[model samples]
Target chain A: MSLCEAEKTFILHGVEENFRIDGREREDYRPMEVEIGIISHAFGSARLRLANTDVLVAVKIEVDTPYPEKPSQGKLDFFVDCSANATPDFEGRGGEDLATGISNSLSDAYRSSKAFDLKKLCIMKGQKCWKLLVDILLLECGGNLYDAVSLAVKAALWNTRVPGVKSVGIDGKNVELNVSERLNDCVPLDVSGAPVMVTVCKIGEYCVVDPSAAEEKCSSAALVVAVSQGNITTVLQGSAGSLHPTTLMDSLGLGVEVANQLNIALMETLQSAPPHFDVGFLK
Target chain B: MSRKELLSKIGLRADGRRAQELRRIRCKLGVFTEPDGSAYIEQGLTKVLAAVYGPHQVRGGRSKAQYDAAIVNCQFSMAVFSTGERKRRPRGDRKSTEMSIHLKQALMATIKTELYPWSQIDVYVEVLHADGGVYAACVNASTLALIDAGIPLKEYVCACTASLANNDIPMVDISYQEEVLGGPTLTVAALPMSEKIVLMEMTQRFHLDHLPKVLKEALRGCKDIKVILDEAVRNHLVNVGSSSGWVKNK
Candidate 1:
């Protein structure tokens, strides 16, 4: 994944001409395969393979008291574990910092009401609510991790079916809730507004989406844009290097445009697809 | 006290398996393109992913590198959500550390270390789901990935788990249900072609007299798995050769 000056120039020239090494255009996304319910033990699970970047997302829901500030809203915790399987560099706790960073960003991006509505998860005010733990494991890192993770998480939530409550019984200090026997009576999560984060790296003169590991090395600064239903959720300026104000603004504009197009394509693919049985890793 | 008692009146063991049966094994190789070698294997409900990346130069301190042997580094981690209950951390636990060491031991035995003297071979195994026999699944998957990376090996390293159901009938491929039923579980990792057992582990006490039968059942299972894996490798090579226009007229 090392990118020298010569290699960077070759990529830049290819991007300028609207063609990539894999014969993809500037806006073209690599072929992706999404499968749900791979981890049978979890309530909801999905794995997405966007080229070489493989992301596995599993959602585990448990009943717990709601937050003091947001009494009616449920909890959504995100954890990104960069497994050593991804690379030798991520061995031990080496990847902890990056994993934490990705998890925190995901939490923030999905916190806003414009993105994901957390209120529906509340079962009974502050007493009883569902806590959805979205655990993301990074299996490989070819590049474009943000896109792959988001897609997998979204798909996992989509396939998640929450158990139905038939009745609630408050007996003394203990409260019991009844459920239906038919599993089909469960409710699925509404993910129409789930934000999809796209990492747009500013390499050399032009900005690019879905940068491979080599392109990422050459890039000075990057922008992470979270788009939900064509509306921008959050835009975070990243990268250790600096970016001019004008270039930053330009990057933001392109980010939103590309995010919108990405969403449309994503929705079209998810909606028209059949039930995916070939889970990730297994594929 | 007989086969009927071992299988019970329902004709099923503690985990509901026939005495001479194996757990369902679902596997895939080259699951990731970034890694030089990667594979995912699910034996029954236990799921493990093994990745291999090297034959390349050894990183870090040069003093550790041997002039005549390739260093094999292994790390084993299980997902927090993998078990029945949540785990505190993925690795660094006592069980994970032990598993990691055992993995290194198993892989090193098969990989031809002498071929790449000063180079380091890294094998990382992650357990996504834990039913039982985590080490065995990891070892098998790692073997597939190493072959996928085109690394030379003395023989295919296959692993399997066995447990004495009702103290006599040896059940091949133990599952979570069997493990929880308080039986004598034995796991073995071996080079099947060489008939050499590289690693052998057992949890709980077992009768010395019944050990031989259990070990024999496990080895049979390992040999069966090795055959399947060999066939898969051959099929994969054929597919790649035909697609790359290297299809030879047979």
Candidate 2:
């Protein structure tokens, strides 16, 4: 969706005036709606819609042997699928590049042990562990994909329930574990330290958070910052154009501030909603 | 071949539904604004989203455009986490490609392609959840999306799945449990208003003598589904009409 020179000038002027095309302040985000436990097949799932950009994340747990180097910690894998329903450009292998970018950034954001502790997934240390597969699906791409995907992923992990191990037996070279059969016998993952990403787009001289599709097209450089517990876990510079050092520092600060507020708001929403509330695309 | 019976002694299926009953179908049209038309549908636990983009000038290149009719392009995809087991890829797999071709065939049969010559219509469906009858759900959702796009159609295209139980009783709308129980499934997509079948597919082989009955049952299910969809369209029209104040005709 290319814009004419006149349209870009209009958006540039809007950002400079502290008003966006949607009449939002530079720091304001688009209205968001999030639903938890939307996918019944997964152990935990979430769907988040930020205006038109929609993201769905589901966490599936499986039993596997821990990695030899990281024997005491379980695994966390992220997969992203960009659907053609979002756009014809995402058909077949067209969206592979974008999917890989998003998944890789998510892995980097969660790589820090302070941001996300993997030890909780361990079932029997090196012998057995719970492997969590976090799959993200992009149903629509209005704009601000990084923010929406990160928020949805955090919610999904918070809802995930790792089954309790009833017993573990070792016999020479073989190790066996019995998972609790009762549905209630499970533990929810602690997500207080999970990072929330914020994309700060540099438009004209000002940095705007949560840019719409048109706004995104107008900006040439941006910073994607993932914040966890008031600290920055990951900072990815996405610059199509060179950024001044001062502007880059300014944007990073703005990203962290916005991400912290977003994390608090997300936790409040998750806490207020009942566990069995039925909500999805229908609502 | 001894296995658990699909239908219980009381004639209830595994999901506590009757033999001829369908799973609950709840659908909404115009779910997304970016697409020319979009729809979301839930058939029990199976959910699907469909979007239609065109009837506009051909994209990518001009060589693919046909002069006589609007080209129908279809893509079928499932979310990576859609199934009980995580799928490695969303689309471009063998099964997804086959479903895409079948979807194109079914949609082409109902759409009035001659109205938009030298143009293309892009229909994309994504399965959010896959319990059973994923193909049937995609077809139904795409039909609604096409309608929402205001495309000209001969009639609504509906699809349904039917299977034989006890080698005699034909069942309508098989679920995942039923599909896994080792029964032959007959899937049919048709223009129910005119009782014309556009596509028919089967998974397993059954006795040739029982083919007609199962086929008949599936067609009947399609017709029933069409009625439900028609009612939904009328209700949607009324809601839209009232919102736009179209009922002020004196």
Candidate 3:
């Protein structure tokens, strides 16, 4: 996918004209399609397709002892698996570096209590708590992975239902918990404060949101901003290029605005969809 | 044996399927645009996606390229959440490595490797759901992906699993529940047109006397699967051809 100098110049000119190569404005995002509750085995699941980049997320819940320092709060772990079906380059251990990068950024974004409250997942202080394992599978790489992964993760978390505990008995350093037998008796997490990541790619003199694969190659650097409730939760700089302070500030502002809009649209879509609706890969 | 009965007294299996019956198979070709060719198939609850990437120059280094025949490389992976219990890792385990080698063996037997000298064809299969017959599903899906890539093959390579039910009756296309119910399962990959067995693997060995009937049932299942896959390929070709105005003849 190496682009010649002429192709780079053409893309630069398009960005300067406020129209991207894909006929999108600087802050315009590619049309995204989201489906939830697709994986029947998982506690929660979501599949998001942002143009050609497809991401599948599934959340599984387990009961484990809470960390000593965070006894009152539960644990949330993110794991990313890059499937070879996405590309031959991801075969075997080739995609490990990229997978780790994405998972690390996600954990950083969700670490803040303001972004996602982990206390609700706690079942008992220091003894037992729920652990949410969010597994993300990358099926395609159109570009802008951070944004797509974050949105898909948020949707999966929204779909997660923690089994309700009817009773918790503790005696002599032993804890016994009774989970409800009814399948529908569960608690859904409050994801209103979950962060939505927006990648602001700097191409030429303009900043672009949701850069296509081609545009991404032309960009000197990019900023990944995770926004929760209109506040920046985590900011990550990617690529080997540097950004001026003013440009960084501008991209940050743009990232927050776009992220806010994306969050609203995502929530609306998740709420409007019918329960138990599944549009798997068959479509 | 404390195992539950795999076949009831009425000749119906646990899933209500009769002996020699295959699970419903649905597949689609060219499911992804990035790969040279891609296909997705679902055999009952087992879902697999396969992608073919080469026939170009070998990757990594030129030293690994074979001068006589093109290398057929295969990788088999399962999603962590594909099973009833979440897998700790997607791949790199001993079981996956064995499955990868077995998959390559099956595909290599059908592909015409000598046609493209010093090149390589990489086939990757990812299991999204693993109800049973994961290896068989991978082989079937890879065959379709190779066909979609326009790779030359001697014939359609189909795989199936068979088990002895009620000590004499043979059942085809064993599911995960049946596999766990304690039965000797035999898996066979074959080229149905030529009736050549590419690979045969068995788990929990049964009496050698019972092998012939089980193997026959598996081969029959493979032949039936070949018919379904062949029809699917033709239908897919028609749809792709028609959509691009390929109907107009010179």
Candidate 4:
């Protein structure tokens, strides 16, 4: 993704003019295409394509005993895999760093009880709990990976369905639970408070959301802010160059503002998603 | 693990296809703009995507470059949700590493590496779903991606899986259900025109007398795949040519 000096200058000047090379406003996000229930085997799945940054998320549920420290709460685990199809650099264990970084940020964003509630996943007090395993795979890297990954995770969690427990039997320290056989007996997860991350990249002096790969190369610093219902849940700074405190504050404000709007649009789109017609890479 | 018959009395497979019939194959080339070449393929329930990048200076270090032949590096990975049960890791696992090595071997036999000395070509395949014959699908998709990259090849390399049904009848293109039901699976990747086998692997065991028949069925399947891929290449060229107005000029 090397940009020549003149190309960098062109992008820097374009940002200073309040317009990006692709004619997008500084605060505007690229058109995003999202598909739900793409993975059949998983309890819930979603694929999000923000221009070329492609992400696929799947949520799998397993019942297990709750941790002694948190007997009333279930568990949430995030795993990220950066496929080599995105780039040769991600082959084998090469992408572990980036995958770990994204997964950790997601863990942090979902840590606050306001953003996600683990208690709802509990099946029984101190005995059985549903563990939600959210796995995200990156097929392509066009930049703004944090935002794309976060959105896909949220969508997947929203689509998740927890099987309903029909009965629980306790006999001699052995507890057995019967899950309902009916398909509609499953419970949909509560994702109203799921966080949505926005990447505010500072290109020259102007901060932009959803920076393209070319713009990302020109920028020296960026702020990733996760917002849940107009409240900031997590903030992480990725700085390739130093930034003033005032500039950081400005970027954070813009990130939260854009994230709130983005959240509304995402919910609307998910609500009005078209009926399934077997969509995937084939289409 | 059901005792249900794999092949019915009429000779139809579990999916209702004849023993000699391969599953439906649908493929598209140049699916992504970022990669030098990209392709997506669906063989029945198994779906795969392949991307090719290279014929340029080797990254990392120059010592890995070959003096007389180009380096072919391949990585094979599957999505965590691709299998019936979730996979803990996509790659770096023993199965994936073995698949990657086998993929590199099959592709190296077809690509013309002498023309681009001191360079490397990276072929990466990601499986979106796995219902069986995943390796074969990866090989096919990588060939299409290499073609889209305009890399020279001696001939197209295609792979197919075959197994013995009812302990006697040979079947082509074994699905996940068939593979699990029981029987030895013989996977062969070869150049159909030359009738040269680039790589071969057999799982489970059968009578020595039945080996030739199963191998022949697998090879025949590869040949059939080559025909389908050749047709796809021609159709792709026609579409690209027409869209570029090359055909109109003529």
* TM-score values for chain B across all models: 0.94, 0.97, 0.97, 0.97
DockQ of each model against the real complex?
0.77, 0.78, 0.72, 0.75
Measured against the true structure, the TM-scores of the candidates, in listed sequence, are 0.94, 0.98, 0.97, 0.96
**Best of the two (1, 3) by lDDT:** 3
- CAPRI-style class, candidate 3: medium
1 or 2, which is superior by TM-score? Answer: 2
Off by over 4 Å in 4: B1-4
lDDT (10s digit) by residue, model 2, range A30-106: 99998888888899999899999998899998889999999999999999998888888898899999999999999
Q: List the residue pairs that clash in candidate 4.
A: none
Q: Rank all candidate structures by their TM-score, best first, as comma-separated numbers.
A: 2, 3, 4, 1
Q: Give the clash count for each candidate.
A: 0, 0, 0, 0
- Against the correct fold, how does model 1 do in TM-score? 0.94
Give the per-residue lDDT of model 4 (tens digit) for B1-250.
Answer: 1366778888888888999999999988888878899999989999999999988889889999989999999989998889988787788889999999999999999999999999999999999889999999999999999999999999999999999988898999999988888878899999999999999999998899998998899999999999988888888888889988887543
Task: Please identify model 1 stretches exceeding 4 Å from their true place.
Answer: B1-6, B14-16, B247-250
Q: Report the first chain's TM-score for all candidates.
A: 0.94, 0.98, 0.98, 0.98
Deviation in angstroms for A151 in model 4? 1.1
Model 4 CA lDDT for position A67:
96
lDDT of 4: 0.91
Angstrom error at residue B250, model 2: 17
Rank candidates, DockQ, best first.
2, 1, 4, 3
